[model samples]
Target chain A: MNLIVAILSGAVVYAVSVLYAGIGETFTERSGVMNLGVEGIMLMGAMSGCVTAFHTRNLALAMLIVILTGAVLGLIFAFLTVTLQSDQTVCGMAMLILGTGLSGFLGEDIASKPINLKFTKIPLPVLSEIPIIGDILFNQNLLVYIMYLLLPLATFYIYKTRWGLKLRALGENPAVLDAAGENVFAMRYGYIVFGTTMMAISGAFVSLAQTNVWQEGMTAGKGWIAFALVAFSSWNPATLALGALLFGFISNLGSNLQIYLPGVPTEIFSAMPYVATIVVLIISTGNFRKKHTAEPAALAKAYDRESR
Target chain B: MSAMNKFRFEKREKQSALRTLIITAVSVLLALVCCGILIFSVGSKPLKVYETMLTQVFLSPTGIKNMLRSSLPLMFCGLGVALTFKMNLNNIGAEGQYAAGVIAGGAFVLFGPDIEGVPGMIITALCCFLGGAIWALICAIPKAYWGVNESITTLMMNYIALMILAYLCLGPWKMPRQNTGMTERIPRSMDIPEIMIGDIQISVGVFIGIIVAALIYCAYKYTTGGYQLTVISKSPKSAQYAGISIKKNILMVMSLSGGLAGLAGFMQYAGVAHRIVENMPNNAGYTAIVIAYLSRLNPFTVVVVSILFGGLQNSTAYVQSLGVPSQIATMMQGVIMIFVIAGDFFQRYRLVIAKEGKA
Candidate 1:
């Protein structure tokens, strides 16, 4: 029963974090920009959330502030890449370094000082008692629950809405969107800012609500995993959620199995998520090649109106 | 095609070189400004910190040796990273490859066939190179056959490799009865012998690095494979049409790249640390990437750039002696990378201010 609960909990956290980052990345990629800076942005957000919560002890406000901080940085990245037309890779890399360096420097100050910030936990009153399944699924933090709600809403918004249609069109061919009475640059900018903000919030969720402590390099490779999950899911928000859950399970399983399999060499188990990512990537891309799975056509390739 | 036309061509050449020089100067100045900001934050004079850093790296023979020793691995890693990068392949797994080398080299020292009073150093170094190259092949294989993105795959492999090293150091390979999470020291026979000229502790690794740099330069400039990579990077379709095998080149480039990084890994262990420990190589792979990119992927340039960065890093220890944080140098290194990437803009594209009528 405990093992089942652990698996469910692991899946939920993984799904939520992946969902947030995946949705946001989808928005950016859809607009013909790839934010390789996702990890860095998330790092900064994690630091901001931890530090804010440490000083103010207001978990809710800290979360809000961290998300907003992500939005602001995302806007800066968009401004450089979209407005100034800087090399997306270079700007993205710069944003990453800037985010990482600033956060690490700030984390030094936040460490050693304990805060009474609470980790997010289950809030459903009766649903928590349902069974082995309900106990695991329904008993996560309010923040994670919000992520569950956001996932379907994001899917609907991306696939159903007029704005979503314009966003996809912009990614496919910015000139067509520009000709069809929509501001291509503006839409791209909006998506980048919005996507990076969510990515940041996802990272902050780990530091503020999950761990409730500011650990240096604590996000580890979670950001990169989120980035890989985007590809594994093939640009679908819902499928990405599934992929994230799978990764989360892999990650949590390693930690949990430490006790059960003490002699198995903990480091080998620690490599599970990464090894899994590579395997998944190989499988997915291989499948794509085999079946001729059509990519978004303009994924990561910038569309220039004048050039076109 | 007259005399005036020739003068115009000469003028253009002078102007472009002048522009490059100015941009480089500004970037260095920006880096210094960042350093100054750090000094101020740490409650020290910027000039004093700079002076101490310079004196520490160049004035002291020990510091020079240390810098060269640190730079030896970087030289290889930088060249390897720069080589793949020229083909538009971002092989960020040099860190993993480096770690893999240490693990592979460590095996030789710990368990390799012991020949009668043999030079263990040569055997261990060869093992390090082979280990790094083989580990790099793991990343190369998938990229070659499976169409996998090498960047993320390599980066992910870094974590796995680090974990493996951690497991061995802390568990099965633990030095018997040691308090720390480190393997037992390799035998001194496996150590890279140092050449002492007065107070300097320069190892044979530096000499090897120079030779390797020269060889890599020759390979890139004169070899068909190097030319093929450059052509493929510019236009893969054209290369394919011209009958160059993409998969073969990818494998060869990645293997060679990994081999270089692996050698750096071995050098770090046999020359510097003398044992595989957690955090061995200490972000050297990552920083080497920055150096490689900054040098614009030229093998010869990688050597010059690595030495410069190495000097800056060496000076940091001196600056730290002034009661300031050692992390200040790392911050500076990060800032320099940003500027370096930004500098590429000036090289490739010229900024033009549009007039009011342009819109």
Candidate 2:
């Protein structure tokens, strides 16, 4: 019983980090832009968040810095892919390499040190007493709580709002949006910046809230996993949340199983999340019926108004 | 919005070779300027840093040898990446393929029959090539059959390959009496030979890489298969209309790409590391992507570009000596790529002042 609670709690922590990135990517893809630099951007966020928290001893300030860093990167991506009409995949690769290298170079001084400030878990009073559910969901850091609010709000905004319809329309058929006198470029830029900001905060959650220390490439491949989760969720915010939790559960299960099954190599467990991601990707995309899946039609393609 | 009306872009039908060269030079200069600003922020003189970097990487005997050594894997991986890029298949799984190559080559040396001399080298190389090709086929088969995105699948497979390698080195194949994750070294007899010219030693693997690059260049230029790949990359629908088999081409090109990358892993293991250590292929696969792009996917150009990139990599030690982080090389590579990609825009379109009647 104790071990179950521990695993559940660990799963939530893992879920929250990826959940932030998954949600952000969902928005970006919905706007018909595929940003493959999530891993590199997350590394930048981790390094920036750790450095700010270490220097200012202010978690709020660190969070803001991380978000700003993500926005700056998004601006560059938008200029290249949206404005200059460069290849999205190549641009994303460049961003990933740049972000990874810059983070390592800039964070070298503080890589060895731990931040003095960290986001502490704030347990709700009445919810804390609600059996197993309370301990796993309510006993998380402030970032998790923010995510809880953001997930539902994002779902509502994406489904119910006028802007959300326009965003989805842009991904499906930008020409149709253009025919309706909507600014395709501006809408894409807006969602892209917003999405990248969310991705950065996810990185901040890892360094400031989860680990409280900055390590080179600490985000590892979580950025890639987040990307896979976006595909698994089929571009829906609510389904994305669920997918994040599933991946988190699988990720935590690996470590937990390692303790119970000592004979098995830990590498197998470490690789579970990635293996699951690939399998899920193949299954989700393998279907021949285009109507069944929710992949953005314009995903990874450059939009040009004059070409058509 | 008002500022956007000042200029408009006009598409160029074709870019002259001289114009392409000039634009490329400008991109490199722009990238240097950006890095210079970064260096300035870090309190270092960019000119002095660059001079020392160049001198250490090209002028010194030790630097030249190290550059050649690093260039081997980059050349191999670059050639592999170039093949896929030519076919418009984004196969970023070179990293995984490289790891699989090391594992296969290592397995042959450790568990296979105790053969000596040239036949043993032949067997090990074949096994490594097969390992990489098989690893790549995991993604290739799916993509060819289902139209699945190879980029994400290939990237995800990298982690799986690395995990398999980690398991082997840490568990079953671990070197005796060592706590580290590394396999036993291959016998000296099985090691790839190196030629010493005066004081500098150059691995024969470098020559192999160049030979492979030349062969690929020939294949791309002179073969019917190459012409089919070009058509497919330009327009898959057109290729289908022309009766070119898209599935067969995807499988063929991807396998060749993977095979080349696997050979890179074999080179790293047999010529450089001599063991399947944890950090054996260290970002060579990723670096090769940059080399492939910078060289415009030309196999011969890949060789020249790989040498340049190899020199930058070898200069990490010199940069670290001046208190600059070695990651400066990585950062510079990224910056250069960004600028070059952005510059490619100018090759296709030219900016002109908008006419009064234009929107």
Q: Pick the candidate with the highest TM-score.
A: 2
The C-alpha stretches of model 1 lying farther than 4 A from their native spots are A287-291, B1-18, B34-51, B115-119, B196-201, B314-326, B353-359
Residue B342's lDDT within candidate 1 is: 60
Q: Model 1, A54: alpha-carbon shift in Å?
A: 1.8
Candidate 2 C-alpha lDDT tens digits along B1-359:
65687787889988798898899999999999999888777777888889998888887788888888888888988999989988888888898998888889888888999985778888888888888888899999989988778988888888888888888888789999999999988777878898999988888887888888888877777999878888899999999999999999999988888888888888877777788987677778788888899888988889988888988888888888777876888889888999999999999999888766575
lDDT comparing candidate 2 with the true structure: 0.86
Cα shift from native, residue B285, model 2 (Å): 1.4
DockQ for model 2 equals: 0.72
Instruction: Go through the candidates in order and give each one's C-alpha lDDT.
Output: 0.77, 0.86
Chain B TM-score by candidate, in order shown: 0.88, 0.93
Instruction: Report the lDDT tens digits of candidate 2 across residue range A1-308.
Output: 87888888888999899888889889999999999888888888998998888888888888889999999989988999999989888888888888888888888878869787899999988997899999999988899999989999989887899988888888989999999998899888988888788888888889888898888878878998898889878898888888888888898888888988988878889889888888887887776556467888988888998895
True contacts kept of each: 0.34, 0.67
- Candidates in order, TM-scores: namely 0.91, 0.96
Task: Please state the CAPRI-style docking class of candidate 1.
Answer: acceptable
